[model samples]
Target: MLNNQKIKKMHKLALYESGEGKKHLAISNYYRSDYIGLALIKNFFLTTIAYGLLLLIYFGYRSEYLMENIHKMNLALMALQIIGLYIIMVVGYSILTYIYCSVKYAKAQKGIQEYYKGLTQMKKAYDREERRNGRITGRRTKA
Candidate 1:
Protein backbone atom coordinates (compact mmCIF):
# COMPACT_ATOMS: atom_id res chain seq x y z
CA MET A 1 0.00 0.00 0.00
CA LEU A 2 2.97 2.29 0.56
CA ASN A 3 3.88 4.53 -2.37
CA ASN A 4 7.60 5.19 -1.97
CA GLN A 5 7.81 7.76 -4.73
CA LYS A 6 4.83 9.65 -3.36
CA ILE A 7 6.20 9.50 0.16
CA LYS A 8 9.60 10.78 -0.97
CA LYS A 9 7.93 13.64 -2.81
CA MET A 10 5.79 14.46 0.20
CA HIS A 11 8.87 14.60 2.39
CA LYS A 12 10.61 16.87 -0.08
CA LEU A 13 7.59 19.13 -0.21
CA ALA A 14 7.42 19.31 3.55
CA LEU A 15 11.13 20.12 3.77
CA TYR A 16 10.77 22.92 1.30
CA GLU A 17 7.61 24.32 2.91
CA SER A 18 9.36 24.52 6.25
CA GLY A 19 12.54 26.10 4.91
CA GLU A 20 13.40 28.63 2.17
CA GLY A 21 10.28 27.48 0.30
CA LYS A 22 8.17 30.03 2.17
CA LYS A 23 10.37 32.89 1.06
CA HIS A 24 10.61 31.50 -2.46
CA LEU A 25 6.84 31.17 -2.68
CA ALA A 26 6.36 34.71 -1.50
CA ILE A 27 8.90 36.04 -3.98
CA SER A 28 7.35 34.03 -6.80
CA ASN A 29 4.06 35.84 -6.28
CA TYR A 30 5.54 39.12 -7.57
CA TYR A 31 6.36 39.92 -11.17
CA ARG A 32 10.11 40.07 -11.88
CA SER A 33 10.12 43.78 -12.64
CA ASP A 34 7.98 44.59 -9.65
CA TYR A 35 10.22 42.61 -7.35
CA ILE A 36 13.39 44.23 -8.69
CA GLY A 37 11.83 47.69 -8.62
CA LEU A 38 10.75 47.26 -5.03
CA ALA A 39 14.22 46.16 -4.00
CA LEU A 40 15.76 49.10 -5.86
CA ILE A 41 13.44 51.52 -4.07
CA LYS A 42 14.28 50.05 -0.69
CA ASN A 43 18.00 50.21 -1.44
CA PHE A 44 17.68 53.81 -2.59
CA PHE A 45 16.09 54.91 0.67
CA LEU A 46 18.59 52.98 2.76
CA THR A 47 21.52 54.35 0.77
CA THR A 48 20.22 57.90 1.11
CA ILE A 49 19.87 57.55 4.87
CA ALA A 50 23.32 55.97 5.20
CA TYR A 51 24.91 58.68 3.06
CA GLY A 52 23.19 61.41 5.09
CA LEU A 53 24.48 59.89 8.31
CA LEU A 54 28.00 59.68 6.89
CA LEU A 55 27.90 63.35 5.89
CA LEU A 56 26.68 64.32 9.32
CA ILE A 57 29.47 62.39 11.03
CA TYR A 58 32.10 63.84 8.71
CA PHE A 59 30.85 67.36 9.37
CA GLY A 60 30.79 66.74 13.10
CA TYR A 61 34.34 65.38 13.11
CA ARG A 62 35.68 68.39 11.20
CA SER A 63 33.43 70.93 12.83
CA GLU A 64 36.29 72.99 14.29
CA TYR A 65 38.27 73.10 11.02
CA LEU A 66 35.14 73.79 9.03
CA MET A 67 34.22 76.70 11.30
CA GLU A 68 37.70 78.19 10.99
CA ASN A 69 37.67 77.97 7.19
CA ILE A 70 33.95 78.62 6.75
CA HIS A 71 34.48 81.94 4.97
CA LYS A 72 37.42 80.67 2.84
CA MET A 73 35.58 77.54 1.72
CA ASN A 74 33.85 77.58 -1.69
CA LEU A 75 30.38 76.65 -0.39
CA ALA A 76 28.97 76.10 -3.90
CA LEU A 77 31.75 73.66 -4.86
CA MET A 78 31.39 71.77 -1.58
CA ALA A 79 27.66 71.41 -2.11
CA LEU A 80 28.18 70.18 -5.69
CA GLN A 81 30.78 67.66 -4.59
CA ILE A 82 28.55 66.28 -1.85
CA ILE A 83 25.63 65.99 -4.19
CA GLY A 84 27.75 64.29 -6.86
CA LEU A 85 29.08 61.74 -4.36
CA TYR A 86 25.58 60.98 -3.13
CA ILE A 87 24.38 60.44 -6.70
CA ILE A 88 27.20 58.05 -7.42
CA MET A 89 26.54 56.10 -4.25
CA VAL A 90 22.86 55.84 -5.02
CA VAL A 91 23.43 54.71 -8.60
CA GLY A 92 26.03 52.12 -7.62
CA TYR A 93 23.87 50.66 -4.90
CA SER A 94 20.82 50.65 -7.15
CA ILE A 95 22.66 48.67 -9.82
CA LEU A 96 23.80 46.09 -7.30
CA THR A 97 20.33 45.84 -5.81
CA TYR A 98 18.83 45.34 -9.26
CA ILE A 99 21.17 42.48 -10.06
CA TYR A 100 20.69 40.83 -6.68
CA CYS A 101 16.94 41.08 -6.88
CA SER A 102 16.85 39.65 -10.39
CA VAL A 103 18.88 36.65 -9.30
CA LYS A 104 16.71 36.15 -6.23
CA TYR A 105 13.55 36.24 -8.30
CA ALA A 106 14.95 33.73 -10.77
CA LYS A 107 15.96 31.38 -7.96
CA ALA A 108 12.51 31.64 -6.39
CA GLN A 109 10.92 30.81 -9.73
CA LYS A 110 13.11 27.72 -10.13
CA GLY A 111 12.23 26.50 -6.66
CA ILE A 112 8.55 26.94 -7.33
CA GLN A 113 8.86 24.97 -10.56
CA GLU A 114 10.41 22.06 -8.71
CA TYR A 115 7.70 22.21 -6.07
CA TYR A 116 4.99 22.16 -8.72
CA LYS A 117 6.61 19.19 -10.46
CA GLY A 118 6.59 17.25 -7.21
CA LEU A 119 2.96 18.16 -6.63
CA THR A 120 2.04 16.93 -10.10
CA GLN A 121 3.81 13.66 -9.46
CA MET A 122 1.95 13.25 -6.17
CA LYS A 123 -1.36 13.85 -7.94
CA LYS A 124 -0.50 11.21 -10.54
CA ALA A 125 0.38 8.73 -7.80
CA TYR A 126 -2.95 9.32 -6.08
CA ASP A 127 -4.84 8.97 -9.36
CA ARG A 128 -3.02 5.74 -10.13
CA GLU A 129 -3.87 4.35 -6.72
CA GLU A 130 -7.54 5.29 -7.02
CA ARG A 131 -7.78 3.69 -10.44
CA ARG A 132 -6.13 0.50 -9.20
CA ASN A 133 -8.65 0.18 -6.33
CA GLY A 134 -11.60 0.80 -8.65
CA ARG A 135 -12.43 3.97 -6.76
CA ILE A 136 -12.30 5.94 -10.01
CA THR A 137 -14.65 3.86 -12.13
CA GLY A 138 -15.91 6.64 -14.32
CA ARG A 139 -14.09 8.66 -16.97
CA ARG A 140 -11.65 11.14 -15.42
CA THR A 141 -12.59 14.79 -15.46
CA LYS A 142 -10.07 17.60 -15.10
CA ALA A 143 -11.11 20.06 -12.43
Candidate 2:
Protein backbone atom coordinates (compact mmCIF):
# COMPACT_ATOMS: atom_id res chain seq x y z
CA MET A 1 0.00 0.00 0.00
CA LEU A 2 1.15 3.55 -0.83
CA ASN A 3 1.89 5.66 2.24
CA ASN A 4 0.47 9.18 2.62
CA GLN A 5 3.88 10.76 1.95
CA LYS A 6 4.32 8.69 -1.19
CA ILE A 7 0.85 9.56 -2.47
CA LYS A 8 1.44 13.24 -1.85
CA LYS A 9 4.81 13.09 -3.54
CA MET A 10 3.31 11.32 -6.54
CA HIS A 11 0.58 13.90 -6.85
CA LYS A 12 3.08 16.71 -6.61
CA LEU A 13 5.30 15.09 -9.21
CA ALA A 14 2.36 14.55 -11.49
CA LEU A 15 1.32 18.16 -11.26
CA TYR A 16 4.87 19.30 -11.84
CA GLU A 17 5.21 17.14 -14.95
CA SER A 18 1.89 18.37 -16.31
CA GLY A 19 0.99 21.74 -17.89
CA GLU A 20 2.03 23.59 -14.73
CA GLY A 21 5.54 22.26 -15.19
CA LYS A 22 5.61 23.57 -18.74
CA LYS A 23 4.57 26.99 -17.53
CA HIS A 24 7.38 27.04 -15.01
CA LEU A 25 9.85 25.93 -17.65
CA ALA A 26 8.66 28.64 -20.02
CA ILE A 27 9.08 31.30 -17.31
CA SER A 28 12.63 30.17 -16.78
CA ASN A 29 13.25 30.37 -20.52
CA TYR A 30 11.86 33.90 -20.59
CA TYR A 31 14.31 34.94 -17.90
CA ARG A 32 17.10 33.24 -19.76
CA SER A 33 16.22 35.18 -22.92
CA ASP A 34 16.40 38.43 -20.98
CA TYR A 35 19.81 37.52 -19.67
CA ILE A 36 20.97 36.61 -23.17
CA GLY A 37 19.70 39.92 -24.53
CA LEU A 38 21.51 41.80 -21.77
CA ALA A 39 24.71 39.93 -22.50
CA LEU A 40 24.42 40.66 -26.19
CA ILE A 41 23.88 44.34 -25.53
CA LYS A 42 26.80 44.49 -23.11
CA ASN A 43 29.06 42.74 -25.60
CA PHE A 44 28.07 45.11 -28.36
CA PHE A 45 28.76 48.11 -26.16
CA LEU A 46 32.18 46.80 -25.13
CA THR A 47 33.12 45.94 -28.69
CA THR A 48 32.12 49.37 -29.94
CA ILE A 49 34.14 51.05 -27.22
CA ALA A 50 37.14 48.94 -28.04
CA TYR A 51 36.79 49.67 -31.74
CA GLY A 52 36.51 53.40 -31.06
CA LEU A 53 39.64 53.37 -28.92
CA LEU A 54 41.54 51.47 -31.57
CA LEU A 55 40.38 53.88 -34.24
CA LEU A 56 41.56 56.80 -32.14
CA ILE A 57 44.99 55.22 -31.74
CA TYR A 58 45.22 54.51 -35.45
CA PHE A 59 44.22 58.10 -36.27
CA GLY A 60 46.91 59.44 -33.93
CA TYR A 61 49.60 57.41 -35.70
CA ARG A 62 48.18 58.27 -39.13
CA SER A 63 48.17 62.01 -38.28
CA GLU A 64 51.86 61.96 -37.45
CA TYR A 65 52.64 60.05 -40.65
CA LEU A 66 50.50 62.42 -42.72
CA MET A 67 52.19 65.47 -41.16
CA GLU A 68 55.63 64.08 -42.08
CA ASN A 69 54.63 63.02 -45.65
CA ILE A 70 51.38 64.58 -46.96
CA HIS A 71 51.09 68.22 -45.83
CA LYS A 72 47.33 68.61 -46.53
CA MET A 73 45.51 65.57 -45.07
CA ASN A 74 41.99 66.43 -43.74
CA LEU A 75 42.13 65.04 -40.17
CA ALA A 76 38.73 66.45 -39.15
CA LEU A 77 36.93 64.85 -42.08
CA MET A 78 38.58 61.48 -41.41
CA ALA A 79 37.58 61.59 -37.72
CA LEU A 80 33.98 62.43 -38.60
CA GLN A 81 33.81 59.53 -41.05
CA ILE A 82 35.09 57.05 -38.43
CA ILE A 83 32.61 58.30 -35.80
CA GLY A 84 29.72 58.08 -38.24
CA LEU A 85 30.59 54.53 -39.19
CA TYR A 86 30.78 53.47 -35.55
CA ILE A 87 27.39 54.98 -34.78
CA ILE A 88 25.78 53.27 -37.74
CA MET A 89 27.22 49.86 -36.81
CA VAL A 90 26.13 50.12 -33.19
CA VAL A 91 22.60 51.16 -34.08
CA GLY A 92 22.14 48.40 -36.62
CA TYR A 93 23.43 45.71 -34.24
CA SER A 94 21.20 46.94 -31.39
CA ILE A 95 18.10 46.80 -33.58
CA LEU A 96 18.87 43.26 -34.72
CA THR A 97 19.44 42.04 -31.17
CA TYR A 98 16.19 43.60 -30.00
CA ILE A 99 14.19 41.88 -32.71
CA TYR A 100 15.78 38.47 -32.08
CA CYS A 101 15.22 38.62 -28.32
CA SER A 102 11.64 39.78 -28.70
CA VAL A 103 10.88 36.86 -30.95
CA LYS A 104 12.48 34.42 -28.51
CA TYR A 105 10.51 35.77 -25.55
CA ALA A 106 7.24 35.66 -27.44
CA LYS A 107 7.78 32.03 -28.43
CA ALA A 108 8.54 31.07 -24.84
CA GLN A 109 5.39 32.74 -23.55
CA LYS A 110 3.33 30.97 -26.19
CA GLY A 111 4.73 27.63 -25.11
CA ILE A 112 3.80 28.40 -21.50
CA GLN A 113 0.24 29.19 -22.48
CA GLU A 114 -0.03 25.97 -24.45
CA TYR A 115 1.16 23.97 -21.47
CA TYR A 116 -1.31 25.71 -19.16
CA LYS A 117 -4.14 24.84 -21.52
CA GLY A 118 -2.97 21.21 -21.64
CA LEU A 119 -2.94 21.02 -17.84
CA THR A 120 -6.48 22.37 -17.68
CA GLN A 121 -7.62 19.70 -20.13
CA MET A 122 -5.85 17.00 -18.14
CA LYS A 123 -7.56 18.10 -14.93
CA LYS A 124 -10.94 18.09 -16.63
CA ALA A 125 -10.35 14.56 -17.89
CA TYR A 126 -9.27 13.38 -14.42
CA ASP A 127 -12.38 14.92 -12.86
CA ARG A 128 -14.61 13.27 -15.39
CA GLU A 129 -12.99 9.89 -14.78
CA GLU A 130 -13.36 10.25 -11.04
CA ARG A 131 -17.03 11.15 -11.35
CA ARG A 132 -17.72 8.16 -13.60
CA ASN A 133 -15.81 5.69 -11.43
CA GLY A 134 -16.91 7.16 -8.08
CA ARG A 135 -13.22 6.97 -7.08
CA ILE A 136 -9.86 6.93 -8.87
CA THR A 137 -8.47 3.41 -9.22
CA GLY A 138 -5.26 1.88 -10.43
CA ARG A 139 -7.02 -1.11 -11.96
CA ARG A 140 -10.42 -1.78 -13.51
CA THR A 141 -12.87 -4.24 -11.90
CA LYS A 142 -14.57 -6.87 -14.14
CA ALA A 143 -18.33 -7.10 -13.83
Candidate 3:
Protein backbone atom coordinates (compact mmCIF):
# COMPACT_ATOMS: atom_id res chain seq x y z
CA MET A 1 0.00 0.00 0.00
CA LEU A 2 1.20 3.50 -0.77
CA ASN A 3 1.76 5.92 2.11
CA ASN A 4 0.13 9.33 2.25
CA GLN A 5 3.21 11.11 0.97
CA LYS A 6 3.54 8.75 -1.97
CA ILE A 7 -0.13 9.14 -2.80
CA LYS A 8 0.18 12.90 -2.76
CA LYS A 9 3.18 12.68 -5.03
CA MET A 10 1.25 10.52 -7.45
CA HIS A 11 -1.65 12.94 -7.47
CA LYS A 12 0.66 15.82 -8.17
CA LEU A 13 2.22 13.94 -11.07
CA ALA A 14 -1.22 13.24 -12.51
CA LEU A 15 -2.22 16.89 -12.23
CA TYR A 16 1.02 17.93 -13.85
CA GLU A 17 0.63 15.50 -16.75
CA SER A 18 -3.08 16.26 -17.26
CA GLY A 19 -2.38 20.00 -17.18
CA GLU A 20 -5.05 20.74 -14.60
CA GLY A 21 -4.12 24.35 -14.01
CA LYS A 22 -5.87 25.23 -10.77
CA LYS A 23 -5.30 21.93 -9.05
CA HIS A 24 -1.70 21.84 -10.23
CA LEU A 25 -1.06 25.33 -8.96
CA ALA A 26 -2.50 24.55 -5.55
CA ILE A 27 -0.56 21.33 -5.22
CA SER A 28 2.62 22.94 -6.45
CA ASN A 29 2.31 25.72 -3.93
CA TYR A 30 2.00 23.17 -1.13
CA TYR A 31 5.05 21.39 -2.48
CA ARG A 32 6.98 24.65 -2.71
CA SER A 33 6.18 25.53 0.87
CA ASP A 34 7.28 22.12 2.08
CA TYR A 35 10.50 22.44 0.13
CA ILE A 36 11.20 25.83 1.62
CA GLY A 37 10.58 24.58 5.14
CA LEU A 38 12.97 21.69 4.67
CA ALA A 39 15.53 23.98 3.13
CA LEU A 40 15.33 26.30 6.11
CA ILE A 41 16.01 23.44 8.50
CA LYS A 42 18.99 22.27 6.45
CA ASN A 43 20.32 25.81 6.13
CA PHE A 44 20.06 26.30 9.87
CA PHE A 45 22.32 23.32 10.54
CA LEU A 46 24.86 24.47 7.94
CA THR A 47 24.89 28.09 9.09
CA THR A 48 25.32 27.08 12.71
CA ILE A 49 28.34 24.95 11.93
CA ALA A 50 29.89 27.64 9.72
CA TYR A 51 29.32 30.44 12.24
CA GLY A 52 30.55 28.27 15.09
CA LEU A 53 33.83 27.71 13.26
CA LEU A 54 34.15 31.40 12.52
CA LEU A 55 33.56 32.25 16.19
CA LEU A 56 36.17 29.75 17.25
CA ILE A 57 38.71 31.28 14.87
CA TYR A 58 37.91 34.83 15.95
CA PHE A 59 38.23 33.98 19.66
CA GLY A 60 41.40 32.04 19.06
CA TYR A 61 43.03 34.94 17.24
CA ARG A 62 41.81 37.46 19.82
CA SER A 63 42.76 35.30 22.82
CA GLU A 64 45.13 37.90 24.26
CA TYR A 65 42.72 40.75 23.73
CA LEU A 66 39.93 38.77 25.31
CA MET A 67 42.17 37.91 28.23
CA GLU A 68 43.05 41.56 28.78
CA ASN A 69 39.34 42.52 28.88
CA ILE A 70 38.23 39.35 30.68
CA HIS A 71 37.65 41.30 33.87
CA LYS A 72 35.37 43.80 32.15
CA MET A 73 33.71 41.43 29.63
CA ASN A 74 30.13 40.50 30.36
CA LEU A 75 29.47 36.83 29.57
CA ALA A 76 25.79 37.52 28.89
CA LEU A 77 26.63 40.09 26.23
CA MET A 78 29.00 37.74 24.44
CA ALA A 79 26.45 34.91 24.47
CA LEU A 80 23.76 37.20 23.12
CA GLN A 81 25.98 38.33 20.24
CA ILE A 82 26.68 34.75 19.18
CA ILE A 83 23.01 33.81 19.33
CA GLY A 84 21.98 36.93 17.39
CA LEU A 85 24.58 36.27 14.68
CA TYR A 86 23.37 32.70 14.23
CA ILE A 87 19.76 33.84 13.92
CA ILE A 88 20.74 36.52 11.39
CA MET A 89 22.71 34.10 9.20
CA VAL A 90 19.96 31.49 9.20
CA VAL A 91 17.25 34.02 8.32
CA GLY A 92 19.33 35.59 5.56
CA TYR A 93 20.09 32.24 3.93
CA SER A 94 16.49 31.09 4.20
CA ILE A 95 15.19 34.27 2.53
CA LEU A 96 17.61 33.95 -0.37
CA THR A 97 16.71 30.30 -0.92
CA TYR A 98 12.99 31.02 -0.78
CA ILE A 99 13.31 33.76 -3.42
CA TYR A 100 15.36 31.58 -5.72
CA CYS A 101 12.94 28.66 -5.43
CA SER A 102 9.92 30.87 -5.98
CA VAL A 103 11.32 32.26 -9.23
CA LYS A 104 12.25 28.81 -10.51
CA TYR A 105 8.82 27.38 -9.68
CA ALA A 106 7.08 30.29 -11.35
CA LYS A 107 8.99 29.73 -14.58
CA ALA A 108 8.15 26.03 -14.49
CA GLN A 109 4.49 26.75 -13.94
CA LYS A 110 4.44 29.06 -16.96
CA GLY A 111 5.93 26.31 -19.11
CA ILE A 112 3.41 23.79 -17.79
CA GLN A 113 0.57 26.18 -18.58
CA GLU A 114 1.83 26.51 -22.11
CA TYR A 115 2.00 22.75 -22.48
CA TYR A 116 -1.57 22.48 -21.22
CA LYS A 117 -2.73 25.10 -23.71
CA GLY A 118 -1.11 23.28 -26.59
CA LEU A 119 -2.59 19.98 -25.49
CA THR A 120 -6.05 21.57 -25.31
CA GLN A 121 -5.75 22.89 -28.84
CA MET A 122 -4.67 19.49 -30.11
CA LYS A 123 -7.63 17.75 -28.45
CA LYS A 124 -10.05 20.25 -29.96
CA ALA A 125 -8.63 19.66 -33.42
CA TYR A 126 -8.94 15.91 -32.96
CA ASP A 127 -12.57 16.18 -31.89
CA ARG A 128 -13.39 18.42 -34.83
CA GLU A 129 -11.85 15.91 -37.25
CA GLU A 130 -13.85 13.08 -35.66
CA ARG A 131 -17.07 15.03 -36.11
CA ARG A 132 -16.24 15.79 -39.77
CA ASN A 133 -15.68 12.08 -40.46
CA GLY A 134 -19.17 11.22 -39.13
CA ARG A 135 -17.61 8.42 -37.07
CA ILE A 136 -14.82 7.82 -34.58
CA THR A 137 -11.57 6.49 -36.06
CA GLY A 138 -9.50 4.65 -33.49
CA ARG A 139 -8.74 1.17 -32.18
CA ARG A 140 -11.65 -0.66 -30.51
CA THR A 141 -11.35 -3.26 -27.80
CA LYS A 142 -12.96 -6.66 -28.32
CA ALA A 143 -16.06 -7.18 -26.18
The digit string of per-residue lDDT tens for model 2 on 32-109 reads 666567857786987698777988798697877867866576778877988798887887777777777667666666
Using TM-score, give the best candidate's number: 1
Deviating ranges (above 4 Å) for candidate 1: 135-143
Give the Cα lDDT of each candidate.
0.91, 0.68, 0.72
Listing every candidate in turn, what is its Cα RMSD in Å to the true structure after a full C-alpha superposition? 2.5, 8.4, 10.7
Q: What is the per-residue lDDT of model 3 for residues 1-143, given as tens digits with 9 covering 90 to 100?
A: 33475455556656666565654465465566776677667887888889889999999999999999999989999999989988888889889878876776676677667656766665665566557555455544332
Clashing pairs in 3: none
RMSD of 2: 8.4
Residue pairs with backbone overlap in model 1: none
Of 1 and 2, the candidate ahead on lDDT is 1
Record all residue pairs in model 2 with backbone atoms less than 3 Å apart, i.e. clashing: none
TM-score of each: 0.92, 0.51, 0.55
- Residue 126 shift from truth in candidate 3, angstroms: 11
lDDT of 3 at 108: 64
Runs in model 2 with CA error above 4 Å?
1-40, 43-72, 135-143
Ordered list by TM-score, greatest first: 1, 3, 2
